[model samples]
Target: MLYRFKSQATADLVMLVADAQGALRLIGKDLTPEGVISPDQLPWAIDILQHAWREDNDLGLREDTYATEQLAEQDDENPDVRLSQRLVPLVNMLELANKAQVAVVWSAS
Candidate 1:
């Protein structure tokens, strides 16, 4: 599955299932077929995403032998990169949508 997040303020942001689910979970959103994030919610969502990103970075999972061993077994690409870097585009979309006073919507396909 793929998720496409759209906002009038920016280009649509597309993410794969694992990434989309992880990001939405960080922002307290459910993995529904479709959902909306109003402007009022954008700030809070951005804050949560940023905080999670920081926490993920501070943990330094890439350097941990245990974490590295686990990462090696996953089919996904670069756990370190996916954990935080993937959130950047969505966060940027939320910020832009907030500035424009528009809602961001997402649908799964």
Candidate 2:
């Protein structure tokens, strides 16, 4: 599954199931079929995500929860790019959306 997030404040942000759901959980949300993030919630979500990006040394929940046997076949030239890398786009999206006071919505595909 994939989750595509969108807001009037920024371009759409797309993520795979594990990564997207893991992020939702970070802000204390369940993996629902559909969800929305009000601008007011951006700060809390952003805080947790930045914390994980700085602290988690492993591939993180994003990879562990989603990776399959075939994941082993993929090269890890830069495993660091897996979970933490996603923060960049998300952070940018949340920050901009927050400033614009727009809601971020997501749904599975």
List model 1 lDDT by residue over 1-109, tens digit each. 8999999999999999899899888888888989999889989998999898888766765456677687688858554365777888988889889889999999999
Give the Cα lDDT of each candidate. 0.86, 0.81
Candidate 2 lDDT, tens digit per residue, 1-109? 8999999999999998988888898878879989998878888887888888766635566456666554677866434455677767887888888889898899999
TM-score of 1: 0.80
Models 1 onward score TM values of 0.80, 0.75
- Give the Å error, residue 56, model 1: 1.0
- Model 1 pairs whose backbones collide: none
Off by over 4 Å in 2: 57-80
Per-residue lDDT of 44 in model 1: 95
Point to the candidate with the largest TM-score.
1
21, model 2: CA deviation in Å? 0.7
